[model samples]
Target: MPAFVLLIAALALAFLLSRLLRLLAQFRRIQRIPVSTVALLPGSGQAAVTGNASGAQLSSPFAAIPCVFWSIEVQEYRSNGRSGSWRTVLARTSDAPLVLDDGTGRVQIEPAGAALFLQDRFAAQQGMFGGLNQSTLDALERLGVRTRTWLSTSRRLRIRERQIRHGERVFALGEIARAGAQAALASTPDAPLLLSNRDAPALARDLTMRMLGLLALPLLLLLAALLIGVFG
Candidate 1:
């Protein structure tokens, strides 16, 4: 076996192993923590909670669409007249805190670093000369662009964003506990966060499936490398 070939395979194996380990660790953590209601939890500890999004309605940066949490991605089509691909021009996520109401009480979620998996999403594309709807044109303005100048460029722009709407049930994992009489619940500063539109059980299953796929990569690569060395 060529030393360099073996080295490359080893590096890939290391990366795959790291990812696999991380997935397993995360899964275990999620498993050990039971879901708690906002009204019932220790004063401060890592926990899982299920609730509805409430509090102030979030305004999306690009379209000003109402939501609790949102992610926006804008892409511009680039072409050489013979070949083209959509290129991302702007992407951002909302940092606004949202209230999670579990019927028992409300928990304020600071979603600064939380991973979100929302299914209520939107995506669209528009081009020059009134080729798009009026709403899309108005949305482009909120995203910081002049409608006339944008369409005059003769380039197609794609807008994509997803939101967790108010009154929607969602799962949230973080360090949360009672915050005295003044506040119902609050997330600790150093807690691991996992917020999603899927319920706790379904989200756990999805994570495990993804983890297994990542775990398979290293083994497959190792087997392929061994076969090549033997046959070559």
Candidate 2:
């Protein structure tokens, strides 16, 4: 029942509560704004749109798979004698401009700083005896990442690639603006664009689950502190 322990737990709880409140507000705001079609998009203001993305095909960094949008995350496992943990070595995302077609009309999307919620398209792990494919090796080389130490076999590593296939259905949230004669989605400093394969309802459900999971630890800590403070 140390006062410092109680104080630390209380602070952690307060910080997490603030984050939860912010996320809740965001969820409410998104819920209030109805999803719009490209043809019906407002001349100016925030809007959510769903469409099939069209763009020049690009090769994924790790898998070399064709996609319109791609991201790769590379992590290496390190052992601390008795325990092991994975540390990220490289991460990259594509910043390409694409068009979203909803059958009614098309809108341009610049995805540089957008938040992406994409599912993994390719995943692989390599251990001491395992070897990475030539394409992946070439990709790692291009990124200037060496898998092995100076003299030893490559360290245990995992690589995951996420992508949006050309013409894939997508969900987008951002400000709607006119790009010359065409309508487009643009991100502002206050509201960065959000892109996802999942629809709004699905994204909200995922966010709720995340908030619930985040709630558990802080709540448990606060409860423990309270009980200890009362009975210790």
Name the best candidate (by lDDT).
2
**Each prediction's Cα lDDT score?**
0.73, 0.83
Candidate 2 lDDT, 1-232, residue by residue in tens = 5899789767977888887886675577468788887878877988998999888889888777888888889999989999988999998888887789999999988786776678888988788656688787777878988867888777688888999988899988888877689888878786778788888898788778878988898768678869988999
What C-alpha lDDT, on a 0 to 100 scale, does residue 43 get in candidate 1? Answer: 73
lDDT, model 2: 0.83
Model 1 residue 27 distance off true place after TM-score fit, in angstroms: 1.6
User: Which lDDT value does model 2 have at 152?
Assistant: 72
lDDT of 1 by residue, 1-232 (tens): 6899789878977887877776675577578888898777667667778899975677775556788789877777778889988888777777777778888977777676666656647777777533557777777777775445444654578777888888889888876643345233333444447778888788878889988898777778778868988996
User: Which pairs, if any, clash in model 1?
Assistant: none
After superposition, candidate 1 runs with Cα above 4 Å error: 1-8, 61-64, 73-91, 123-160, 177-191, 230-232
Worst 10 residues of 2 by lDDT: 21-30
**TM-score against native, each model:** 0.69, 0.80
- Superposition TM-score, candidate 1 onto the true structure: 0.69
Best by TM-score: 2
Question: What is candidate 1's CA lDDT for residue 116?
Answer: 60
